[model samples]
Target: MGAWSRLKGAFTRDAQISSPEDLLAQSRERRSGKVPVTNDSALRNSAVWACLRLRADLMSDFPIDVYRKVSGIQVEVPKPPVLISPGGSEVGMKEWMYSTEFDLDRGGNCFGIITERSGVIGPDGRGLPGRIDLVELGSVSVRGKGSTITKYVIGGKEYEPWDVWHEKQYTVAGFPMGLSPVAYAAWTIEETISAQQFARDWFAGGAVPLAELKNNAKTIDREAARVARENFRAAVDSSGLFVHGVDWEYKPIQAVASQSAFLEARQYGATEIARFFGVPGDLIDVAMSGSSITYASIGQRNLQFLIMNLGPAVGRREEAFSRKLVSGPRFVKLNTDAMLRMDPEARARTIGARITNRTLTPDEARALDNLPPLTDEQYGQFDRLFGPRSAPTPPTTAVPGASS
Candidate 1:
């Protein structure tokens, strides 16, 4: 335990608690010739936002199911009230899950204060969580001795570890807190943001090249030059005509390479961000070259994403939910079948094939499409269109010989 605690402290050496307002202010500040890295500033990049949103959106859409091992098979069980409405009557599980996942993706940690618990006792002396109100990470301070979190200070108020619900990902050995990917990707995100700002400022005339308007016949004085330059800039800025004398010549300096390089840098930043967030570049509309990968269908692409990118995150969440939300043999499963849903035509063919092969019942297939079972009239209609579904043939041995 002591060794584990020491390792955990090493990972969280710079841990500090601050208000959201303070974090936002710090994010706006420039420090040591680099943009201050914070969740808010990192999200300023469109690619970063897209990656986080994609993960959170998909993860939240997946339905949560509780199951217990029965006879060596997973049998679905009734979800605890906390799993159903984790945040209380005002917030459903989907919204809660989305918020939690968003935090995990951004900060690698999520903190919530348990407000209520069920009557059923869990492994911990406290009952299972009935309501957990998520707190902003900035407002929560985690204090631990070695690997054991002694307490949580949220909004300057203290609470026991049992009273605080914490989930972390991207973990290392003995670390109670997850490592923030944003922290590691800070330079990339900052570079992207700096490029964006440069582009904005450049278009706004901050970096416009100096131009000289000189008289071919006679040299102009400083005062005359300043007036002419101001007039020219004002006219250009407002899209007004700048009528110059024929004697005067205007030659503007142009550096086209910088603009082209800026564009390339921006593209590279997007691709890098996609990589950092474990999202496919194409999924976020990030252009990349020198790749020949292709997907036969959207389902195949989604399947690859589910397996490669989201699988581990989903597993971590499942483990956390199983350990904390349920007890004994019961476990939690986030149904990712929704992510792999095929197009209507493809889905129909697959379901039809399953029914034909006796792998799935007609009613069960209908349920997959969220339709109710067929009535007698519908069965009659089906029988008229196609022969009735054949019942399995009964096997006979000695009885068949006797009948013969």
Candidate 2:
């Protein structure tokens, strides 16, 4: 069976699996055809209804966490909020409700306790007795393929291009129940109060123009783009763009600079026209830093491996963490393996049959010509290294500058 089919079968046969239909039926039985309409009773009924609906929805959306969350409902109740507010307000709550109680016809079987509370004004301008809250009905988890590594053996030695394969699993906990009736009622009342308060605040001169907010957001985006462009330029410049010991070679640094400038210009233009903007040098910096670290780490790891395989004489370390030369044979072997895994047909075409003491036929040469091109850009660099042309030639003219 396919992987997904096997997973589905396992899930279907799980003893703890609870279907949404079962939960809905239990909810119906709990009400016993008598839907509560009173404010307090209605709220309780709504909470129960929410639990049923949530359970059903989560059964389809998060099948993996179903068993654990449903079975462990009793255990998840006392746990602190998976979500909460900073001001000690019970803004978010979580609870797990089980199906066993429903099956046994127990009063509290299908229910989960909600702890957090938010007060809301009633229609009579009085505080509502109950408040809106969140609860967790169950938990779900999923696992999938992670990382991959490729290795190749040539001339009685083995080389690895990528050396790690890791898998990741995710778990989420929340209520399968719908919103609590009391919470909904409280929220409606609170919204009415909030609308009035908002009107007061707005008339009290706290409200600002939507255009102004848009302008501010745009300003922030432009500033962020400017900063990003500056950082990118600095990085590229420091890395140096020139091709050493080569003629008429185009520098990749110029392309990087051009791309960075284009991105900056586009960002500035977007800031001028767009209504929404992002914060400058905030969370984006964290992401950029992470990306930099990932790229650097991978490059460093590969370089280290290559140097080690090349041996001490040619691959001398300039610093404790630096390598002077790398093993060409090992690099080629590893690259071939990676290519084979990524594109088997292409690898087969590139590494055609090698018959001993045989001359290539014209048809064979033609077949070779029809083979797919190499995906790696490094091969082009290698070709240039050994080719007649060795130095990069300056561009005759700069690319047309963008109109401000």
Candidate 3:
């Protein structure tokens, strides 16, 4: 069964997990439909690592800045984990969200433990949470009341589930547990890893000669055997030759395994892993010899990637952060435009189109491109570029010329 289906079935089968205390114990035990994707080494595969890095870096570049609706327009908010850093440090919101989403993308679950700095308030008057800090899933466990998860246990301390931000992909068991792609696609990843290892081992040690010398007449004496061994070792290791006399025959060994097919399988597995992660095959340098997806142009492929793959992934985070980080009309949205942002001329054309269409004002388009609004004189200059907007005055009356 597919991982999602299996997860659903297992959750439904064990629908009786209602007791909060019991859930803590049950969570410690293996839950139904749980599959182990592998430990953290999942990123060791070059293709997986490349895809994940691309996704994470792309999403990260799309800022997760906070905004609130005021009189129908969204305004930036000041309070955030970091105050001024741009590229994002350990405490920066972008870095945190980027890493968290990386985990969700790869392992299917991402978590954060609320800290006092998070500013999240609890229902109780005195006891509550204010903010959250990203926490590793390995350090946290989920416990529930009935089918509903109530709390998460980290180390020995227990905190309400509401206090912990959990972002998951391929969710099952009431959204508390996630089904990892790595787990469901374990066989493919394993095959890729194996192939990689095989290649490494081949190049590392395959330098040795693949043959042995045999005495035709009889088994050589110890001295003769020793000399033969030395000669064979020198020939194979350094010179790639067989310097043997009569009665000593060298037979090059042949591999029973089909190395070519194995290598081809490895290449195939890389693309399959990329597919599982929704990455374009060509993005990872996989030969799309038979792929129908046209990678004809870099721009079009990137545009398609934004619309088809990265857009949804970024949207999920936007929703999650909107729900968890802010309340009411306020929302946290990633600047997805940054992902597919075109060159200056193209961008100007786009914004000009929007302005012409009246979907955006000239000022708003300028703002979107981070340009300040034009001054009155600058506006005149700018409008003049479109040429002679105003009509020329008619010729002065003949009387004025006569007076002169």
Among the numbered candidates, top lDDT falls to 1
Scored against the true structure, residue 109 in model 3 reaches a CA lDDT of 76
After superposition, the stretches of candidate 1 with alpha carbons farther than 4 Å from their true spots are 1-31, 208-249, 290-292, 387-391, 394-404
- Residues 198-234 of candidate 1: C-alpha lDDT, one tens digit per residue: 8887777675665657789888888988898899889
Model 2 vs. true fold: TM = 0.14
Q: Report the lDDT tens digits of candidate 2 across residue range 295-372.
A: 233434334423432223111111110110111111100111211132445444444543122354434644655845
lDDT of 3 by residue, 136-180 (tens): 655666655335666667766778765676777766545456656
Question: Could you tell me how far off, in angstroms, the CA of residue 117 lies in candidate 2 after the best superposition?
Answer: 17
Compared with the true structure, the alpha-carbon lDDT of candidate 3 equals: 0.66
List candidate 3 stretches off by more than 4 Å: 1-37, 65-90, 117-130, 144-146, 173-175, 204-209, 212-248, 253-259, 290-299, 379-388, 391-404
**Candidate achieving higher TM-score, 1 or 3:** 1
RMSD (CA, angstroms), candidate 1: 5.5
Score residue 102 of candidate 2 by CA lDDT. Answer: 24
Per-model TM values vs. the true structure: 0.82, 0.14, 0.71
Ranking by lDDT: 1, 3, 2
Q: Is candidate 2 or candidate 3 better by TM-score?
A: 3
User: Among these predicted structures, which one has the highest TM-score?
Assistant: 1
**Residue 390 in candidate 2 has what lDDT?**
51
User: What's the lDDT for candidate 1?
Assistant: 0.82
* Model 1 TM-score relative to the real fold: 0.82
